[model samples]
Target: MGDENTPLGAPQLAREAKDLVELANTEETVSELLRRGLDWLTRIARFDLATLFLLREARLVAVAARGPLANARVRGHVLDLAAFPMVRQALETRRARAFTEEDHSGEGDPFDGVLDLPPGHSCMVVPLCSGERCYGVLTLDRSECETYPQTVVDLVEVYGQLLATALQNAEQRSDFERLHRQDHEHAKLLESQLGGDSEGVLETSLSPAMRDLARRARQVAETDTPVLLLGETGTGKERLARAIHRWSSRADHPFVTINCAAIPAGLLESELFGHVKGAFTGATKDRAGRFQMAHGGTLLLDEVGELPVELQAKLLRALQEKTFEPVGSDRTVRADVRILAATHVDLQQAIAQRRFREDLYYRLSVFPLRLPPLRERLEDLPQLCAFLLDEQARRTGRRGMRVLPEALARLGAYDWPGNLRELANVLERATILSRGPELGPQALDLPTHVRAPEAPAEKLAEDKPGKVPTLAAVQREHILRVLALTKGRIYGPGGAAQLLGLKPSTLQSRMKKLGIARQELFIIEGPT
Candidate 1:
């Protein structure tokens, strides 16, 4: 407010501009974003009376106005711009400057109607422009100032520029989001048309985290490191492993997977290193183990933590030197297999307890990569959902795929116990049951907590039978249940709809309607 520049520094200005661009490129409605931007900017500028008026299709309507005297009566009382020479000049010039008497030096008309100052009143109108073109005007007023100062004039100009840039960013953001959405749709269209492997998971990710993973995978795919992927179950560890294999130097060869937990200890060694024909009873013929089969290629061991203690030693040896002997034969059958391992269990804990070998843990964890949990990246939900919806539509042969605001709202309210796998399944179910084009709440099969409890059995038995659980009721129960499950991670995990479904705006709506807040659930746990 004091300097010619706004309070924001160069870095802050750039960041705000970037944020506006990001917001503009979003799929959110422009009106909603504009209102939010206006609401926030009013506070940011610290101007008591601020109004944003733009020329829309040759007519100007004040879209966003703030401060005290902005009601119908105050706004309706208007002076003719042409009759007031100063107002006309400000609009015509398309640049920020004071409309005070100093500019004219008393050579112009009295400026009675528009510039008639109230007690201790002063005003400044700054033109909002972008690249030499006028976008709109910002009128800032204060009650205690005697006259518009030069410093105030300059600050207002900077403020106007900031707002204009922000508005531009919002528009650009909207376009980018629309393009991204269309890209997903295009991918689905290609999938359905070409439909080769329906089981292959489509990467609908737009989040930097996911895109960055893809980039890193592509970069390191040529290497022969024994990549150890660490993440929770249902977090797409297998998907990433497969992606690595598909992109790596061993892409032409077989990519084999062995779930260490699934096979027995006795069979695991035989399965991995292969058994000679005469190795044991009922050893019908010579067999090639996963390592031999994946020679000069990639071998993925899933749930590596669950591997038997005895087998861990052998697995380590094979990973170190890439050579193994069949169960019955003494000769070593060398295969150039690149090892990749995935685990959901805590290998360190297993090692400490002596349930898992420490050396094997070190060998596997040498090139460890940890995938982030879904809760850490709520911003990517909308994109993720859109991608999943398209995927479901492609597989099931239905374009009747759409996620209702309410379903998305309810989804955002809860935590995803199953992670991406759960999200995919829910989307698939919704797509399958979609009754109409909208794919509304009816399509969803959300958990009991996400829905209101079925109206009392007594109420159903007594006569007023067809009463559906009100939207408000469903929202209320959903909020409360998630609060309990997550211990009230209002902004935390256990799927707060805003956090879960990735629609903070929509979740906000439901939270308001249901009369729920963080405080309601924060009551002392001492009561019965």
Candidate 2:
């Protein structure tokens, strides 16, 4: 090969340029591509060392290197723009420039400590740039003091441009892949929230009242209007809200739920609107809140009436303008989210007490929907029981379990003060207690007050032979009964643990061992 100063003929240079273009267009990761590019540069430019530095947040990081100077220590070396004047100049001017030891006379060499370059070596910095954007710089150094011919410099410049374009394409592709994965994960999460295939229960409601309510819900689902779901604690407001989301045009997107009463008053704002890093004592990193998570989809503010008065104004603004600032962040974020608010609290009474804002109530209740309590639709009991029992069986891997007519009659006799949630709890307990496929009235374990009087307690007790119950079974049944009586409260006075004469933590441990989920006791509601 000729010396470094000997310029290549036009024809040979053209062939070299074609090969470099093909190398730049190869489908590889950014790091791999940069490494291969550096190898090509060292070979073609007759340089002993080469380094590829990518720009990240105003700092240049050495991503790939080759030759004698390339070592593990040199890779990932970060350079400040102020220190690497020639690199900065090349990036700013979008040109290739050569520097020697003479250029650093009185001024210390930028690469002195980092590269430890020998005296009289020539270093050329080429800007990896396309259009007006400079992705980074490519630096090559030779062992000898030699100038790069005009032809070699031109070829290197062309290589830099092609490499920059490839880097941009790779970054864009990576972003697209990340977004696609996020969308798929969100879809799965929403599917779980809606309780996959549970939305169909509303369509097949046995009760005429429920059927009519489903019809109105479907009508409202077609619109983007705010819907306020009104009902008692266990009347299936959340189920109805999810049905509305599934029925709406935004069903394909996220269906995020945030229980206002579930989070503390101090953290509720951050939960709704999100927060930046260092926003609060426990907030170590940025978090996207319910609103941001539900972007381009639906956001259900469950138990919305429990929201504090101070945050109501901010919530009202978000609803009215679809814009809100994150906690500790002045930048406003706008989300295209459909609002669905659910509450058992009477907004009228709350407004009178000044506990709820009248303006927020008006904005939320644009199309209010009141869910009927389970007692109002006892005719649907049999179908509802079948669906819930089948679902529980599928979940627990215990199949072919059926409820007896006597048990159904007993269930209907009781006025469900806790509504659908109470009924679900009763069924789950009965499922656990029943040893056979059939769940009889005895299996129900209903509180004495709600037992059907027509069944004549003495006669019903005589009908079935009693067997000694397992210690675990007895304990589970007794805990379930107390929890039902306490309406799922575990701590404080009148709670299940207090009635059972056990500490809250001890009761919780027993509950976990018995496979009794707190959600089943408190929040499990039928699809109606």
Candidate 3:
């Protein structure tokens, strides 16, 4: 080191100040900024060691340190305000103070008791403060016996103030980011609740079966009677339930839904009826349940078959009386909620097996509505594909997306065991795989096992030698002739569907089932 008596040149001091200011303005986490700040001070000031402490809960915790022994153990060191008098005084005075070896009394240096510094060491304490707020104290130690010059003390004081301001800004930024994330999550939740497909399953459904179902659902929607929705998995029972809620008088009120199979048997009761604080192990506060949340609206209990037997009785009571007691609370709460329950389980079988209450089943199935499987309503594929593709395009920012007719035919050929939900997933995948605006057959990755198998030639050739064409063959030949007459047109007036006096969607379903391809229809020369 240079002579303690010699002053730092103005140019050198200006450069040193610039470095400290640049380090303080660095966009980094609070802990990282503090660590780098300490490193710069120790290296520039030529000090043997330096420690930065932050005030937390009336105590100074060593947050960052630089030296041979400045490991995790030293950085984690804590000093109570009452225990470290020099550090407390530095923070209270908002000033920098220097101490030499002669300043210590016989009791020994305060830092020596904690940091285990060598005897005859000099140190300086600078308060990391700005305005009226004091963040903490910065302590710099030197192994030499020389006192710190006034210039070095003043430089450290400026660094401390800059670091303190940076720490405050970093914390504020962290809080702002956290709040923004929470607001984004809340917005998504609200969107899911209110901005879902308004028309629901009825939007593009061309199947007469679905139209009839919608007509019946509208009749029952005006009434508060429990509507039991029965369908296979992925058959859009929840979508239909939402449609019914939208059509009902309570449309303005909240529409709440809960999956009975998703929650555990023990906690599902609390999820349905809510619980008071101290109701269970993790119940730190009171919460509204699905029933209370859907008051004056509709409550959909999805996968109702999975509800535990013990909770079914309480549910039945709530349905019958329009009142329920929350878990761990004796006070009765009443809710005017129109209940809709949906499940794929056969309740009659469940009753036979004594797994479900017969009374509860009758109570829930007051106005039962069954959703037709996709295979049974294959005519809806074209419209459904168009709607789904448009939805996916809008979501993924791919505009004017369309599916080729052959690709749609390929989709129709699959016996979708997972129904509409699976169709949506397949279309979404196709949209992602397609490079152009048009989705072709190559974009579809349908499972080979699920594809509708073609009839063996031997089965069709049975018409030769004491064999007659099967009904399927005759139907296929007739549909092919009709398609040829309409020039492969399946929809609209004067199309093959109209020529055959069949609903367009129904004709498509029959054609798919009969394994009739559009190319074969066009190639047919005045029938086979």
Query: lDDT: which candidate is best?
Result: 2
Give the TM-scores of the predictions, in the order they appear: 0.47, 0.56, 0.53
| Ten-residue region with minimum lDDT total, candidate 1 | 195-204
Q: Across residues 471-520, which tens digit of lDDT does each residue of candidate 1 receive?
A: 67876775655444344444533346543464656766777767876566
lDDT of 2 by residue, 358-472 (tens): 9999999999988889877775676778777776766788888887755665675677888988888999998899889998889987776754347677877777444557789
lDDT of 2: 0.79
lDDT of 1 at 181: 78
lDDT of each prediction vs. the true structure? 0.66, 0.79, 0.79
| Candidate 2, position 298, lDDT | 95
Which residue segments of model 2 deviate by more than 4 Å?
1-186, 189-196, 450-528
Error of 2 at 59 (Å): 38
For model 1, state the Cα shift of residue 279 in Å. 1.8
Order the numbered candidates by lDDT, best leading.
Answer: 2, 3, 1
In candidate 1 the C-alpha lDDT for residue 133 amounts to 59
Measured by C-alpha RMSD in angstroms, how accurate is candidate 2? 17.1
Give me the overall lDDT of model 3.
Answer: 0.79
